[model samples]
Target: MKYFLPATLSAYLARTYLVAFLQLLGVLLSIVYLFDTVEILRRAAKFENVSLLLVLEMGLLKLPEVGQIILPFAILFSALYTFWFLARRHELVILRAAGLSVWQFLAPIIGVAMMIGVFHMTVINPISAMLISRYQAMEANYLEEKESTVAVGEQGLWLRQRTAEGGVILHASKVQMPEWKLSGVTVFYFSKEGDFLRRLDAGTAVIENASWVFNNAIVNSKGRAPERIARESLPTNLTVNEIEESFSTPEQTPFWVLPSYIRTMEATGFDSRKLRIHFQSLLAQPLLFAAMVILAATVSLRMARFQATALMIGSGVVIGFLVFFASSFLKALGASDQIPVLVAAWFPPVIALFLGMSVILTTEDG
Candidate 1:
């Protein structure tokens, strides 16, 4: 049985990986195509250079970002397929007859799920962050060099601010959700609201405990300032949530930053439901995947006793989808305050786990 564990686990992992990679690749490519087409259409309408190669490049660059978003679903569906295949082949029956318990069968899938969770959090997510950042930069340069000065891109809002001290140019490339922090920001101050007050730029900016901490600020307050303080610090009463609210998109912040971001938002008297739900989603993903594997195994493992592959697979898929839908519904309900966020987050996984357990137990007892 101990020797059997490694072989069974390896087989399950291989099957899950193959299914997940294929499905995710297809889903991401489709999304990239649509995104690229929309951008090309927008540029061509303006009589700009929207070349075929440019569209291809944009699609290629955006796929990794989409992959990160779809990873959880990929894992779930892949596990389902693997377990279904195993049951359909009667391999599960053989294992059980050889005294392999349901828990033993599940150990490998659990291990794989943990590995995938770590991979998503560290490796895949960073790739998504980098690709998204590059995409914004390219889009920004394109907008700045080609069209109107006040135009916006896929990144976020860009504007010019005028004050007694001088004229300031603001570029906020991305906004963190729920509590709003700005990413890839640049602020320029001018003398007499025309020439320049100074240049202050940061890779990222957030309001923490009421003060704006500019990360990697580059300042140049050089010249024409009888009223202006030269080499002076810029003052802002903006909370992190406020700055985050100003950005139009939520994809700018890395997943690792959302926890602290939510804390910053709540501290500043902001609603963090959306961010909270997204955070909860991270934990729910692996559990959901585990349940899916169990459900698939239960259905497929009984093929020798029940010659209904099509019916079984169809029912299993429907059950999988229902589990997903139930989760989204519960999340929406929780977000509206009808249910607790924690309950909503765990509802799908818990329900699925019990359902899988009950089914396996009934079959074994019968």
Candidate 2:
């Protein structure tokens, strides 16, 4: 429980770990950005309206999300590299001979990993979400798709659809997703010149085969008297897939705001399973990062004696990939409601931590 270590040793170890982490992050981000830019360019080439600059902008906007996905890998590699370098320089051996335990030497690196996780969830995620939202909107516009403009907010669900006349704005006080039904709906009709023509209020609206079926509706024209109808059908290009796809992804929501957003989504009768999983996963990030440090130490601690640097590094990466795969698979199960969110989110990191600790104990203590 004692947090004290030799000040100079702690500072040096922490600085080395920090430098390695930052350098690894930079290298990973650069590789990701370059690959993403190339992919985006390939996709954009098919669209006549999308320019090179726009494609680059979209790629940049999407980098944060990609970076987040790769962060654990970055941490794992950085920790491995840092510990290997120290071992190669005989620093770790000297410290061990001086009566320093493995845990004592690992303390600084673990602390740094925890802080990086916190910073990533708090600051980096929100920025990434905002940029991704913008990129999606721009991409939708360039593709001339109505589905991209749909959004759910405090007031209700809002949608924009294009027609031969101009556009239609649809608002619903409440939604039943998966079925794509709406209650307390209002539809605004507009002319081709962007002039408002009339509005229709419906007690309920249901999406049906490329159009919406409104029951118990009242139509009010700009210059005509209001007319009531028992039911009406309006042409729509909105589909079930489009409506569902319009909602901001759980990852797009910031960690700080996820709780409230999850509540709102649940209250509106929308499925919040994905959001719940994402929020829990964010909460588990620090532990996951710490596990990365433990795994790194396990792999790299013997590098000086074995001198199998390449093999050790390769093994570390394989382990990292396995961990990533397991986490993703668990997340998929969580999102589909096959397992409890907490179990899906926390189990991966917890298992990884225990596994890493077991390896370290067997190697270092035996």
Candidate 3:
């Protein structure tokens, strides 16, 4: 690899690629932040307590998550522009005269993309997860006017649900994993107008299909003395799977945290399909980034005077989006358990890489 491109040349190319990537990222982030701020402002209008500063803060907190979603497109366009600029300045003509092959130059770009993938997994994702978690909390508090339906903390496991008569808040001091049982359970019932209706303290509670069965429960209502019952049932629309999703959503979980969290979900009788797919997808990001570089380079390595830039770029953007949408479709299939996780995660990147390489080989030879 050192022989393929001299150390200085490789450094130069990588530097150029990185500068373009960061510049494009900044541009896109600015545009998204502006739109997000506007949206947050509109949502905060009904709340007298929500200030303009708060709206801006909410948008800034949300921007990283949106950036995570925008990253692949940014890589594609920036790499494409970098290569086109190189060709436009006749820099390639100079390199060609020096006997440098396309691969000699492209290897550096691929390496940069791989590093970016690692950076995203380690640095960007954790930051995004933390900020987005706060963003969700703020959104729920002011805009949505509801807390998360499920949460797990040092205090215990908590859940909430709406009933025809009112709402119920549940707290479990201890959750028996794999057995799907809770001990030291309490349920607070509230009327439709948010008045306290009653409370139930149970020795234990377990889910049986669509309801929670509480054992040795004591009922406390406004007018009546606490009544002990051997068994009690509460009908609910919540399943264990939905509760798991609400507790540890992929967006709110960092990449470093996902594996153990997935295991926890699985241990709690949840299949972990959604989290598994997200994990696999993140694992595949390096290859996907490298593939996008190849695809972008394939469309961009010619001058318009020498080749049709408009047609080639248009075709490239269309193909890039097709690849993106294809990956999304496969992810949806994986979520639905229609396809194997590995296939859904890795296939798009692998095939796109091969296809881009084939086209580059054919064109380079001709």
Candidate 4:
């Protein structure tokens, strides 16, 4: 009975925070889906074949990703509401009079927020990735009229490039980093007008001088004898960066698979800065949630004491946007190598955490 009361209060606070968070999330996602559906309809208007069902499906598919994008705001607004609700009913005053510190009660809310972050990172993200990939495919096929151009797998690297005739397919069994060097390279030449022109089997190939330089290549063509060539060159408009950029974006990659994908991209001599930052950001999400909760608590607690509800709510909203913009700026800097990935990914949360702590300490203790 001694500890039961405190435990019950903690559970109540956690439950309240979670319920508020979910309510806000539901509202925000609904708004996002509606706006997105309208945007999809507008974009699809040009394509007469686009159907209403497809548009609705696309909107539904995007909700998970959109939910994540608005997570921080949801946390902030809900935490604010939860704290304010408790204060409005004088529950916090009663708890304080019973000698419970702010941190003791805030602990449960922060814990719930952290659990939400972990769930989002581990469970929600992979589902969002899958759904968003489908959304992108639908968008591309129906709206953009684009085709997937590149892929990497255990078998090797494969590339398809459009030619005026039809297409050219290239495959490499092994790739060397820092330069576009390949072993066991095969190039297939085909035209849309005809089935195929020829195939080239190269023992080694390297991209240089805006072309593929093959060493010890065997050329095979239809109705012709295979010809051996010591050196052969094929013209290519592709650059290494362009090829790298053509692959799926980080948001399209599943969370659990992102680490290995990052390593693979790094091993292939592709720039993995964006992936690193993204992965780091995921790692920092729990702290970000905690920081948001603290900031929300700081504002809500102040509002409760001073009864400046409007000013405090507005301040919380401003803080949320400021944190978002600062994080985005830092991410851009990290992508451009101006700042360290760890710094870019971590600074905003750390700053917010400290800011919230300072305000709460001064307000509550002083």
Candidate 4 lowest-lDDT run of ten: 1-10
Model 4 lDDT per residue over 114-164, tens place: 999899889988889999889987887899875336777655778877666
The full ranking of all candidates by lDDT, starting with the best, is 2, 4, 3, 1
Taking all chains together, the TM-score of candidate 3 against the true structure is 0.83
Candidate 3 lDDT by residue in tens digits, 139-201: 878887763388765557789888888899998877776577888899999998999999999
Which candidate should be chosen as best, given lDDT against the real structure?
Answer: 2
Per-model C-alpha lDDT, please?
Answer: 0.62, 0.87, 0.85, 0.86
lDDT, candidate 4, equals: 0.86
Question: Where in model 4 is the C-alpha error above 4 Å?
Answer: 1-5, 172-185, 190-197, 201-218, 228-242
lDDT by residue (tens digit), candidate 1, 259-347: 77666555444466766876786667667767766676567556435767677667666876787689879988887878888888888
Once fitted onto the true fold, the runs of candidate 2 whose alpha carbons sit more than 4 angstroms away are: 1-3, 47-49, 143-148
Error of 2 at 2 (Å): 7.8
Candidate 2 local lDDT, residue 95: 80
Tens digits of per-residue lDDT for model 2, 49-146:
88998888988988887888999999999999998899888888798787778888899899999999999889988888888878777767774444
Q: TM-score for candidate 2, please give it.
A: 0.95
